[model samples]
Target: MNVRQDIHSAGVPVLCQSCEARHRGLCGALEPDQLVELSKTASRHGVSPGAELMGDAEVVERYSNVLSGVVKLTKSLSDGRQQIVGLQFAPDFLGRPFKSESAINAEAATEVSLCSFPRTVIERMMRVSPGFEHRLLKQALNDLDEARDWMVALGRKTASERVASFLLMIARNIEPASDPAARSASFDLPLTRADIADFLGLTIETVSRQLTRLRTDDVIRIESNRHVTVDSLSRLQQRCGD
Candidate 1:
């Protein structure tokens, strides 16, 4: 069955990053019984491409971590102009940690796999588990750094620089560090041109133009419409003004 139906069914014991949990999720600091108890109140959900997990202004009751695929955090103007503020990738956490609702909405950019537990339950556990609390704090700090980085990109970076930086960020996510291969570094790109445009504060056409420029300059090459290969790290970092 698909992810949607699978949540309602009992899953077998999964051996992953943690025998108790994987990917720095709540299971990392909890015992098996603790995980099982939380899972009891928890739910698993799959979202189809473009399906919203939480819309803007809606209070969220659960927290999630991506098991597979991607999701995007976005916001829109009352007039309907939208900006993508964050990209969620596999092994990454999703949803607001300390808040109930956000001004932004989160939606699946592709078919998504998620493990969701009730916020109340998780928060309760945090009060008793210092390790769990520290993990959450670290996650928040990481997100803060990413947000600051975006301010630099949106406020100062040019269109070409924005696209180049975007590619570099995706590559970093897929492989913990940058490693070149076969004259071009390649990795799956989870966002579309429009999403990149939103994140970079540019229109779709501008995003396309920058991508073309990067390709022509041999900074990056698009192996597929959705997959990118970077040819030079120095040039890519130079584009970021780093």
Candidate 2:
């Protein structure tokens, strides 16, 4: 049998066969044999919401693939105040490769699932697998681009636009594979109102006011203060002022 057939028949790890990361994440760059090797040391686990996955200035011993749910990245100031910097969804790599220490705190914004491997194992693979290294570089560049975009949003976007943009971001990332033609989505808000405000650089009251405005305009529907349904993602996108 050929390599592809061999991989399908037995080379691929059973646990990884149906994993989203295997198809969409860094593991996609690895060969079937490499996957089997990696799986020997890899572990799968779940984290509760608000739990810290990694803390700032901590030693970097492992990296993870976000299997499901949202991870919020934050940085703290000297006075212990924190700022929400970014969010990672399923299939996103979850650590800074080659860094000796973590520069940010990674916490579960929602109940999260992860597939993690030791840092030494991953770094060794990167040295030997050009494709794996290339994938890591690509993700890093994509993150930088997103950070720049968010900088613009925070620096210049109006409060209404920022809130809309935040909602649009959550909708797209939460259901990344949803049909574009449908233009609709429903999900529980992963972050609380205070957290959302912090991320968007707005006050909690301002966040609530904008959400109320969106609901009144029929752009979105809110139930139980956390459940949100977007009737038309296109309309929501229009509100983003992009």
Candidate 3:
């Protein structure tokens, strides 16, 4: 795994050259012309592992849609304790709109690529594009839904159960382009113990402990640090304490 941190010195900024028109997190109302204009406002870039995208209280000038890789959102307390607030996968939206500052910093959990769009441009385009406002509203609603679901995992689920739910959520969010196997039987583990700890509200030791339990139980096998072969997804789902 050539992590983005080492293989490249500088990242190349790419416009949204995809023929798919709108990327996954688009307001969903953008037309061809609107997309081109939106692309004009966007600049692609990459970040190394542990690189901070938006640090605490950083004014978000642009929002991004992940083209590849994973980003983790986290917040640290005054005592230096950090909590993983969110995990963003490819085709998912990033950045805060209309907010004065980012509540959490987004960091590359791994090497990452992003399509960055200027906030002002997006806001203007949304004003002109058909149904764009509604799409933005819906986007907010969807985010809220995900947050609430994870809140339950954090507040009530067991460690193993939390890991299972996280895996299934990531599986559903991963774009087909990002996963060639698409066999419905296998997927990858893109997060590290530290990453899992933050999102699952457990210690790194706890995450590692539960992962061992999962492996021993025939739930999964570690392909590498960044990959996992799911052996029994039904059983994995059941581990989520469903």
lDDT per prediction?
0.71, 0.91, 0.71
Using Cα atoms with residue i matched to residue i, what is each candidate's TM-score against the true structure? Answer: 0.80, 0.94, 0.82
Error (Å) of candidate 3 at residue 70 is: 0.8
Local error of candidate 3 at 56, Å? Answer: 1.7
RMSD of 3: 7.1
Model 1: residues with Cα > 4 Å off, grouped in runs: 1-21, 175-185, 231-235
Q: On residues 1-242, what C-alpha lDDT tens digit does candidate 1 reach at each position?
A: 23233232233223332322353454676654455556566666688998988788888788877776768888889998787888877666676767878677899888887888788987887887787777777877888999998898888877777777887777765443333343346677777777777778889999888888887887877776777777666678788764
Q: Which regions of candidate 3 fall more than 4 Å away from where they truly are?
A: 1-23, 175-188
Residue 32 in model 2: shift from native, Å? Answer: 0.4
> Model 2 Cα RMSD, Å?
3.2
Model 1's alpha-carbon lDDT is 0.71
Q: What is the Cα-based lDDT of residue 191 in candidate 2?
A: 96
Over 1-242, each residue of candidate 3 has an lDDT whose tens digit, in order, gives 12232222222112333522244456346665565456555677888888988888888788887777778888889898888777877766787777878888788987888878788887787678757767667777988998998888888887788888887666655544244444344556667777677778789898888878888888877766656667556667778886
Put down candidate 2 lDDT per residue, 1-242, tens digits, no spaces: 13344345758977789998888889999998999888888889999999999999999999999999999999999999999999999889999987999999999999999999999999999999999999999999999999999999999999999999999888887844334466788988999999999999999999999999999999999999999999888999999989
Q: Give the TM-score comparing model 2 with the true structure, all chains together.
A: 0.94
Of candidates 3 and 2, the better by TM-score:
2
Please give the TM-score that candidate 3 achieves against the real structure. 0.82
